[model samples]
Target: MILSVPLSLGGLIATAPSARAVPSMARQTGYECSKCHTVFPELTPYGRRFKLGAFADSSEKWDERPWTQRLPFSAALQGSRTSTSDTAAGGTGSSDFPQNDKTILQTAAIYYGGKIMDNAGALVQYNYDGIEKRWGVEMFDARYANGVTVAGREMTYGVTLNNSPTVSDIYNSTPAWGFPHTGSAATQMPAASIVDMTLASKVSGVGVYGMWDDLLYFELANYRTAKTGFFRFMALGQSWNSDELAGSVVEGNSPYWRLALQKEWGPHSVAVGTYGLVSRLKQDANVPSLGANRYRDIAYDLNYQFISGEHSASSRLTWINERQRRNNAVISEGLASNSINTLKTLRIDAHYYFRRQWGGGVQYFRTTGSTDELLYNTGDSLMGSTNGSPNTKGWIAEINYLPVTNVKLALRYTWFQQFNGASTDYVPGRNASDNNSLFLMGWVLF
Candidate 1:
């Protein structure tokens, strides 16, 4: 079936590789994986440029490449075990850890990624979520990029069509490529901002971006629900079914924008950027008469990288502020207690690596927002807030050992200092620390 799909598409689907770090790219460009990454999935300056160029850069002649080289296919597998500090209330540990202390194959994915033409490239992934027991199209990014001289300054411009907002971004500070690259399928954080992963894989976006003098960058795009047209094919096998999306329809095109300034000096590189989105969506597709809910999200981030021989280090800081206006009519309908609410998130992390084989990192994250019982409280002890406050604070620490460039083993711990606005008794008797978890994970790419 996989072979049939590519054959049916013919040359339309050509040599492509993984979106994250994979060997197919190295084989095509005649460079080692380290040339483009400080570690697996973490890009260095050169790696960022390679992606900004639409992954079209290559060392060999395109027409002369062999069939094997032309089909840059790769597969990835992930396994992990998660253990919480304490069992769930009533000994029903399944609520907190469906497969606690059990090593399970969390994910398996196949990727077709790389340059399709002289000026075009793409990355497509089909994945299986072992935990969910489902298969789906995980991510897709296709682009047409080129370089030109604008006012004597070099400018690289491109148009990106993707299923997720930040999937096409070159910076790791963004949501898609942010830290804690891999997570336990057994557990999850409760609160997240709208700009986080809320719209990932749920909508399609078409954006135009440009980088000037390798110093300034800008992008603008519009997104719409991916229920029909080409987007439907791109979004095939999504986690959300059509009926689920129907209840929260994106009424019209949502606008997204980005701007950034970056510089590199010797072994040090730095980037500062801002990005945002504005959308109006149907509060309830069941009630066509109700007004739409409006959301506005704004974010700023900073990234820094240092590289010297076998030593590499990086840091990222990002903050997102979101304002939501619930439909007044819906509020009156007992759907919400407040017509307007706000949520904000902050994340900071630092990482260090020695020879790209051994690495460690730490991350601090926090989410704070308005309190509204109808909106934030669900009455569930483990996954919900008892005080109607959307506040969570935590830190993650991890260490990794890579036997090879394509295989990684990591040990990580997450500690929650506060949850749902309180450190102790956040719920009736459960404390935030009860959710602290330890995770051990392994990955293989070939």
Candidate 2:
């Protein structure tokens, strides 16, 4: 018998102050982080001027190729199209005849980053799914740092559980070159069915991060898996039997947290933050009315960036609070129970860049919730009444192009609408005012 795994030393002691305040753009500009991260998990400004020139390096000037043995690769390509009048049954049904509105090839990814020592570094990703032919592992990051000891003590650190970030198109505001690449009824929730609303390529856990200087940034995590699973009749389409999902078991402890504050004065840069997640669940004697669930979410975001030269602009806003609870339920034949669920969201995004390889953007989202007051019961004959109203809205528009500088091309359009003023014709014969639809996409990066 041999099985042992345990190595997280608080995410390797928080990667030593951003690895001793940045050095090695391969030691100055020998480049990596994909020469500005189209996706090494997103970042650009020549990767933020190789991270603000590794936090203001003495005065700049270091490119003589320090550790050059070579290794860094990247690639991406995408496509899309959609215009609709709403139609549904099993899947891939609307697009209103005409061979379903055309245009495809969604996502393709390939990545690699460098440095094995001299402090440590790594970033790897591989994804290819031409409509699910499969090829996974979307992320991996490893870091370490320790330098600068007196003078206000500068520090940086790291430890990652891959899959990184918030995942829904990376920190909400949607549109990462969109389409039906998952809609946003205020960040996913159309009574949530369709496999509990996709997107969340991965999340495994193990974080211990830090940053001190640009005004503090922090993280402390635990996560232990969550690709997505939290069911409770998903509005009412029923299908949750695998002993009732949610964390599937491995004991407990699932905390996650984050905090941030950033600064830059010249061209103006700002950041504000908060992050969250807390979970616990267990108990299912063959789902005896099922219970024992607890979940939480909290968020806050603000960003601003504008640089002249070729021109650039960015603006963002996000706020969310999601909660869930169940605590031991059996409720009848023997009695035992509890319940509560909640959701609230708001998002806004905008971007603009010209001549530095064309660009455009826009996004808006809103959500409201509260329903399921015992959605159904038939002890007396037929008692099925559940209606809680809270509207939902979504919108997106985008365009991008960069012929070279590590290739990029994009186009996107999306719209979704939901109103619970209670109306049902159940689509058996059509026209209940046909809901709404329109999604389009196209992308390529390398």
Candidate 3:
């Protein structure tokens, strides 16, 4: 059977390759990849169940142990072509991307994923970035879980150790694994939320999470900088830079949390959830002396799915609100007339599948935030905001085909309604629409 599902990137969400499905976990459980994912990384109810089951190692044959259970290894590569309404200036001298209609080998990776022991399982991704010309850790999610009876209801509880906040989520609705899975790394994007996008690769986190009666989910965790120097070697990270490991270190104990309520009846499943992150951070390596900045981010999300016979469908909605206290930045950078600022983002997406081989979807995304000229001034360039606002609004439409189950092909177009707070004359002669982009991608897993 083929899967017609929305292809998404590391939050970007897009399509991938399809084939006989012997990628990683399938090699361990002997279950075809389709049993868990209609689209790679997107989970079926059974896939969620498998993860809650500790990847099912306790159920394996008695003679099998982690070391002998097929190794759980796989590799994949990606390439893409990107065309913008306006081309970047001059040549691709940045060494991180290609120029104009040039297609690039964007990325390649090797993964060690699936069951680690009777009660523990993990997923580790080591990737080489064609743009950065460096290799380091990309993603890691390790968990240990157990089943219990609670007031006659069944529950699955687990502990998670990972590098990013939402990397261990079974649902694809979160920031860590939402759709539009890949894009040209060289493309220029407006500035993003520091709280949500940063601290992703630089820190190590540990948390406790649980699913109760298959209806309620909760988690709590703390994060700190992954130690530099030798820790990078362990991550295949560049050995030359130590400070890069921590980036801007998390001050004190940065806390993160998640909560959700879900229900399923007949062929439909739905969920509503809330999550948050709060961190105290030192400025940058150059100015730690200025003290710390505080960021508090809160989000609400919803997910829906319908499955019957040869077809499956799903949709997700999410919104995030961030409150920031910029004591150090206000004093040192003098960019703020006020000491507090806020940022908000909203995304809504829906998809439909037919016959399990083809699919299409649409997404609307908008970001808006406080205005502070000193903080966002980019000097009349298309990349900078004409005003001191963090406003961007756009729409994306996509079509995807999964010939088998391990590969995906897709075409995506994004239209900008507003960029960096302007709909017209963002730069001297450029409107945000001038930066509209068309991206074509090919992705595969084996």
Candidate 4:
């Protein structure tokens, strides 16, 4: 069975921080990358505040001039090798794990980030996926921010326009900036929460947010599928498959909301937050008259960081639960076993770095959901779930070394304990461990 939701946006497995670690951001603030990052893309408290302020704060008076003078541009390149425990049976070069045991250029990307005006700023990105062999805009965020006093307390508020739901968030605990920051594009992970980068680069959003007394943060936003000419232009001519579009059509706009509380004392910082998305989509893009399917995804998360002298460490936890109302998926689409089903995802990660030069981290992840044979029971060995269950659990361990502030090398390994429905013979003869992988990478930014 094939189920397409209007904002499916392909798999989120390959999503990375296009705007994070941009050298231009460091130049703009007159600070080293360490000022904003504990590790390259992970933000420090000051980094979060910089983003919350719309990236407008600057150290140079010349920032008031035209952006061209500042040369607010940066680029990134990546190369990696992937090795899976077992290649799919009968698999060839074009099959699953195409680059298994092979090294290849993984990505090439260009970024633009700076203050558009005194009160406005934006981060835009366009990149090439070496594995998919495609070039398109994958990240864009424009904002206007200002500060005000409310009840004698400092309040920072802003308006944001961007692609991707959590792209504008200041926390790395969310999907957009979550752990396992980088992964092999040639490898595929099964099962993900609908709210976890599922709609990234596939939709456009507008939001308003405020941070009061540096204590509470709240945001409200709405998103719509980017399928039309104008919206597609906003997405920088990203292409969509005709059949894929015809399979799942967005009915209308979806609402996304966020709330968080943060506190910092000396060298310790902590945050707790909740966010959600509600979407209504046409069950069949070909048969809009069939009505729509409703998806409600809610998540709770926690973030903590410790920084002192040459040591820095952070930890994150995120749990998501999605309630599905298969209005037409059951009868009209025949893609679900029940009218209502619930899916849940949990992730926990932590890492420590010394002088921003060396570090290692680990992540524990799992996903479980209601069984629906019609939707998940495909006989395909590699991507199938013989038992019609959506249950998967895994652990990832990684070690990193930075030769310089702009260059990094990493070795990471993923171990799967459960996949699809089982650890042993999830399919006819393949065990989940068969998909375990080791990835080595080199990433450079300038």
Per-model TM values vs. the true structure? 0.91, 0.27, 0.88, 0.93
RMSD of 2: 19.6
Off by over 4 Å in 2: 1-29, 32-140, 143-160, 163-357, 361-393, 398-416, 419-446
Give the TM-score comparing model 1 with the true structure, all chains together: 0.91
Which numbered prediction scores highest in TM-score against the true structure? Answer: 4
Global Cα lDDT for candidate 2: 0.42
lDDT (CA) for every model shown?
A: 0.74, 0.42, 0.67, 0.77
- How many backbone collisions does model 2 have? 16
Top candidate on lDDT is 4
Better-scoring candidate (lDDT), 1 or 4: 4
Considering TM-score, where higher is better, how would the candidates rank from best to worst? Answer: 4, 1, 3, 2
Count residue pairs with overlapping backbones in model 3: 26
Tens-digit lDDT track of model 2 for 152-201: 76655555443333321122222221112222111111331111111123
lDDT of 3 by residue, 313-412 (tens): 8999988888877775545677454477777778899887675668877889887878767655555354566676767788988788888777777788
Clashes of each: 4, 16, 26, 0
Against the true structure, candidate 4 has what lDDT? 0.77
Put down candidate 1 lDDT per residue, 218-279, tens digits, no spaces. 88988887867778876677644434343235678888888999999999999999988788
Of 3 and 4, the candidate ahead on lDDT is 4
List candidate 1 stretches off by more than 4 Å.
Answer: 1-19, 61-63, 90-92, 191-195, 239-249, 284-291
